[model samples]
Target chain A: MKAVAVLPGKPNSVHLREIPQPKLNDQPHAHVCSIPEGRAVLVKTLQIGVDATDREINEALYGNAPPGGEHLVIGHESFGEVLEVGAKVTELKPGDLVSCTVRRPGGSIYDKIGRNDITSEETYYERGINLCHGYMTEMFVDDAEYMVKVPPQLRHLGVLSEPASVCAKAIDQAYLAQHRLQVWSPKRAFVLGAGQIGLLATMMLKLRGLDVYTLATKPGPHRKSEIATAYGATYVSTKQESMHDLAKRVGKP
Target chain B: MKAVAVLPGKPNSVHLREIPQPKLNDQPHAHVCSIPEGRAVLVKTLQIGVDATDREINEALYGNAPPGGEHLVIGHESFGEVLEVGAKVTELKPGDLVSCTVRRPGGSIYDKIGRNDITSEETYYERGINLCHGYMTEMFVDDAEYMVKVPPQLRHLGVLSEPASVCAKAIDQAYLAQHRLQVWSPKRAFVLGAGQIGLLATMMLKLRGLDVYTLATKPGPHRKSEIATAYGATYVSTKQESMHDLAKRVGKP
Candidate 1:
């Protein structure tokens, strides 16, 4: 299997190399496999997306990472058919399209994004960012439970599921936490970036009825603003004002 | 108004001082307020709970603060009454009981909890932590939108809105986040710690239908375990099993 692994620090050191193919072990769970001891997944990478975290680990210091020297695979975002199952596997079968949970069990998805930005142990072990090879490989094995079925309605976006779900899950979790405090919901929000995650988060926020604002790092009179608007966001350019000011401007009744 | 300000870090050096009460002069729909801001209750705190962070900064190596000192009033978890309001205040009144949002604003409620542990200028602010004076004071003003009406149903637990909300919000957020992912709400889960946050999270989790397990730092039967189980948690001693192990245990079906 050919996978992209990052040789930390020395920039542009991402290597697309042939590693022995990952084989599936048996673990029963169409829903989620416990992180250790039960199963591994072998995914033939179909269209793994380049994540912002991959860029950060490959370039900047976003914190929440272990000192970088391990061979790091760049893409954690992936979707493909489950080619084999662990001997213990009883849930997922061959050809099932699945995605990884941006959250490894016991970790915050927010932190996962932070780690996905820089590398972290938990994020690493979950796949792509850590020792567990990302789906950039011809096949990747994961704890069966962490891999969930990508519904048929979302098959077109199945490969986008891991990343989209991260956004979805984070937003959902944020809402849950919020509701415990207040009886109402947040009807408006500010999304600081306009990249993939930002876009997805923006979309999810809109789905939840929030009047979304996408504040781009770099703004044009009508560039990212247009893209953001198309994606259900009202554009706010940081070039014109900080996120606070923008949220104030929009959040104001 | 009188408040206890954590001047610098020396706990003993805390300043018991008075500052002018907060007065809202902006338009009722000023950009300064978010909708949940209505939930933000201005409480005249009777008692403020001391948190672990205060203990660390005051007793540890943060160094003694300056003479006038950067005073931070130490109470985050608090209970209070609505004393005053701007023309915009409606959801709550001058005498209604209320609590505070663990986080500041701009993000969704779900975003707050998921990012609650992470301090961002936007997500957290107002009358707690650093940005504004905390509740360990005579009177403090907060965004009214973040407050929640105490359910008469849980009247047995005379705990304040802030503390209860923290746990309540966490548990609710966990479920909300889970449900958004695919519609499967968590029926079982684990709380990594049984401390203030953990205990609250446990209660909330249980209320959400999760069979929670508390991983206490020090095993042996203790008050926290009793509280945890009372709220429907299964106990696990951190002394006996690793959190990682416990996480794996919960990860299993």
Candidate 2:
């Protein structure tokens, strides 16, 4: 199988390389093939989203290859299909659409309870990011624990599940933080950037009944600002007017 | 009556000053006496705890006097006895032990919902610390909404309530933050400072079944160290060993 990979610590070293097809127990590394194991899943890649993290990794800003391996696979936002499932895998079956979680568990107690995403350990692992193989290849095998089944009707949008999860988690955190208040009915929300994540967050907050304000450095009536305004969000150009002045005009978020 | 006051923005200007006795509706300013209002209470000052906030205010670091006033009354941590209650004040009555909440409501929506402590507005009001007068005087009047009833038996420790509330709120925030984890059973707790708040937090965490480490600059066997050790927490002298070495020696916290 040919897969996109980058030599860790080498800038612009992204290239396709041949690797052995994955097997059920060949979970961590494809070349280290082993006999099939129950509850393991073999997935055929469908779509992978290239994000800022991937660009930085390719730029050699930060990324670690798997131990004893020279190259790191660089796609973390992924959607795939279940080509095969171990006998003990009851939740997902062959032909099921799926998206795998990015971060893999580390040795922290947080990892022991399914909260590996918030692991306290200094050294952590994330698929396709730090010391782990990501889902940028033709196929990969992982424990069923990391795969989230996506419905067939939503297959086209499944590629967005990873990024959407990031937005969802951020919204969850906002509500959790504001839980300190006796009653918090925020009528307005201010999102500071106009990137993909920011736009997604603006839509989410708008859906939640907040009057949204999306601020960006770029002056606009451009597509991004158009999308924001289409969703009833006020888009402000920080380059044209300072955030302080904008806030003074729009009121508190 | 004599009360401690500071000329706002004037360093070392703390001095005793005479102010008129407080009456119901004499809320925002001591001299602006008005007719009593419903839900108001007159509290006779019992004890006031002076902390770092007072020192900073005295040093002209930050503080505000009421509008059209020159001197700011400098005390926030206070315990008092209810000397009188407004006609419509139902929860509290004369002779009840009480402590006043520090921050009062501002214009932001957060303040409107009784969460003034986290008001989003750039301008805020806090009793004794900002535009409002504090409880350092012989007596003061406030809405019953701001007065928390302290049981008669706990009167001796009432002054500690303000500081204890600060620690309590911090722990609540920590739990709120860690709620992202599926399960977070932090086995070890590390407290960076051994100040009054730090010691209080150390004791609280110790009581909550965590193995706590209280780190301070001074060498151990002192009173603060003794208090920490008495609470079943290990006291580490950071001067003796760097935090990096200490963490490596003990374990993750």
Candidate 3:
């Protein structure tokens, strides 16, 4: 199997390398291979999205190889085709399209609750970013619990689920905060830094019926601002107005 | 007015000092005091809660003195009574019991959207914890928007709101992360450390109908464990089982 990997702590060392293909019913840690592990699926690679985290890992800003390994596989945002499944796997089967979550569970109780993303302890691991092989290979195996199913209508968009999940998490958090005050009905939102995350957040907020405003360094009538406006969001370029002035104009929430 | 303050970068220098009281119509930076700042409210201190952040500030672990000032007031969690309001203040009134939020808005758009708690930039200010004066003083003024009203029934419990808010934020974040799967109904929660935050989290989780378990270093048959049991939550002493074992027993969400 071919995989994209980076030499840990070595900047600009990203390359394609041959790795052993994963085997079904192979339990590296288990004493007996015959023991059935429920909900474990092996996925064949389809698409991998490159984002800022990948760039950082390539730059050796922050990434770690799996224990005893010198290189780390480098892709967390990915779409894949399910090629194999363990005996007890029921949610997914061969030919199913899916997207795998980036961060894997650590030893924390929050991790046990499938909420490792909010684990206060810093022991959590993200695929490709640190201490684990990611889905940037020809194929990978992960617990079916961590994979989200992609519908046939949205197969191409599955690779985008990882980044979109970030926005979803942010909006969910905002609503949770607002839940403190039961009367709060958010009418407006301001998203800074019109990057992928920002634009996705703008789209999410627009979908929620909020008048969205996005601030970015790119001077508009640029494509980014146009996309924001197309989503019924107002776009502002920092070059024209200072953040302080824009915040004042938007006023308090 | 007398307030407890600490000189930044100097450990164990906490002392009481008399600072000038805030004026109703004084605008320190504005060219005119009558510029009609409507949201700012003047609060009279009633109660202040001491937490680890205060200890950190006292030990010079992390805290900043206000700019142009020699020391920073050291209390972020507090309950107070509204003393005065600007022309536009509407949510609160004079003599109203309230709890003022510790963190103040920064230049980020997150701050503008009333979500400064999740502000991405590190420029945000914490009352008494950083560059802003905290609520340990006799009286302090803040924007009416930052104050959470305390009902008469919960007046005595109002001081607990700050610590409770931390737990609230954590649970909110956990739910946000869990929101990825639509059918996720958490059946159990394990709170580690059994401190103020942990206990409060246990209570919140119990309120949400989960079987809550608390892990603490203290031996069982103690007051903390009794409180846990009183809340209908199970208490586990770390002396009996390690965190790793406990997490495995709880299973995955």
Q: Best candidate, DockQ-wise?
A: 2
Summing lDDT over every window of 10 consecutive residues in candidate 2 chain B, give the lowest-scoring window. Answer: B27-36
TM-score (0 to 1) for chain A, all models?
0.74, 0.92, 0.92
Chain A, model 3: TM: 0.92
Model 1: lDDT equals 0.62
What would the per-residue lDDT of candidate 1 be over residues B196-222, giving only the tens digit for each residue?
A: 788878877776676778787788578
lDDT of each residue in A98-195, candidate 3, tens digit only:
99987776656666676777764565477888777777899887777778999989986888899999999878876765554333567889899888
What is the C-alpha interface RMSD of model 1?
9.0
TM-score of chain A of 2: 0.92
State the lDDT of candidate 2 residue by residue for A1-253, as single tens digits.
Answer: 9789999899999999888898776657433222246979999999999989999999999899988889998899889999998898999999999999988766677777777777788876788888888889999888888899999999988998998889988888778766656556778889999887888899999999999999999999899999999989999999998989987887654
Q: What is the CAPRI rating of model 1's predicted complex?
A: incorrect
Instruction: Tell me the tens digit of each residue's lDDT in model 2 across B21-87.
Output: 8767665643422224687888999999999999999999999898898999989999999998988
Candidate of highest lDDT: 2
Candidate 2, chain B, TM-score (2 decimals) = 0.93
Q: lDDT for every model?
A: 0.62, 0.86, 0.82
DockQ scores for all predicted structures: 0.09, 0.43, 0.05
In terms of TM-score, which candidate is stronger, 1 or 2? 2
Q: What is the DockQ of candidate 1?
A: 0.09
